[model samples]
Target: MPVISYELPDRFVAGAVGQPGERAFYLQARSGRRVTSVALEKFQVTLLAERLEELLDEVRRRGGDDAPVPAATPSELLDDEPLDQPVEEEFRVGTMALAWDPEGEQVVIEAQEATEGESAEPEVGDDDPAIAVLRVRITAAQARAFAERALKVVAAGRPPCPLCGNPLDTAGHVCPRQNGYLG
Candidate 1:
């Protein structure tokens, strides 16, 4: 009946209110058009669930001569929908990249091993091995936070390149990379 959608800031499903010593109603969102019903504490969950259930029942009863049956059961009230994809967490160290995938809903952590101190050869000898990959699943909330943090980091701007800490300006500088130093 009542559908609850939670994104960034808030996370909650719609439910019904109850009188003193009475059971309240709750609706957990399943899909775009369906919500399952459950009982909850009054004044805590929203009343929308009860309202939608009443409306749906009324419509069903009007269409059919027999009593309208509920389409779902209380056990199915909780959401079983597939969760959103996780966001990638990347750290840039010099030219190397370390990354991991994290699930926001649960506490999970993964790390990428350092690739330094290795020979230039790509071949893996008996002792040396390739680096392992890290994968994580993060909730929508986690994704949003990650994006926000990246934006802030970019806004702060990066330290001058170690090769040239000073401004290049239009004159440019004399470096092996360049033809000549115009300064």
Candidate 2:
């Protein structure tokens, strides 16, 4: 299956169309006029942002950021609305990874489709093009912006319980740690 690769996206963001925990999480990359949306777990979005930040930090430590890549400001290329209405999940993500391409001088994020249930096979092979893989490339500056935006977006969800660390809806939640006690 051919991978949907976006090399140096002009606009990239991780966004949710609906309320947190009740909505889908997507990683969108747009180059020129081509736009691709890929489905992923909310935690994946959080981890992706964190890892991207780490990658950029490593580059800076190694003097790679000194290149003429031109630092990109998050606000300048940010897309609050990454996708069109009636958002759909391209595929349920199974495994994902991130790496810095020294030659390419970009952070590459790759996500593979997760197969249903458990598998006994020694190896996994996907022949479905529609659910093959999604890859996005972005710069160190863009990564920093993404990390900042993603942290904010994830935090904007339901506030967490101070004691139990569980997300509390507007109606609150019956935290098991409270043992039937609202307080």
**Best model per lDDT:** 2
Task: Report the C-alpha displacement of residue 102, candidate 1, in angstroms.
Answer: 13
Off by over 4 Å in 1: 1-110, 116-137, 158-178
Q: Residue by residue across 49-76, what tens digits does model 1's lDDT show?
A: 3333444445446646443334333342
Lowest summed-lDDT stretch of 10 residues in model 2?
118-127
Per the 3 Å backbone cut-off, how many clashing residue pairs does candidate 1 have?
9
Tell me the TM-score of model 2.
Answer: 0.80
- TM-score for model 1? 0.22
Q: In candidate 2, what are the lDDT values of residues 1-183, reduced to their tens digit?
A: 567777778877888767765967777777886777778877888898887776677677777647523344446755455465455566767777777777877777777777765353212233356556777777767777777777777787878899898888777788889896764
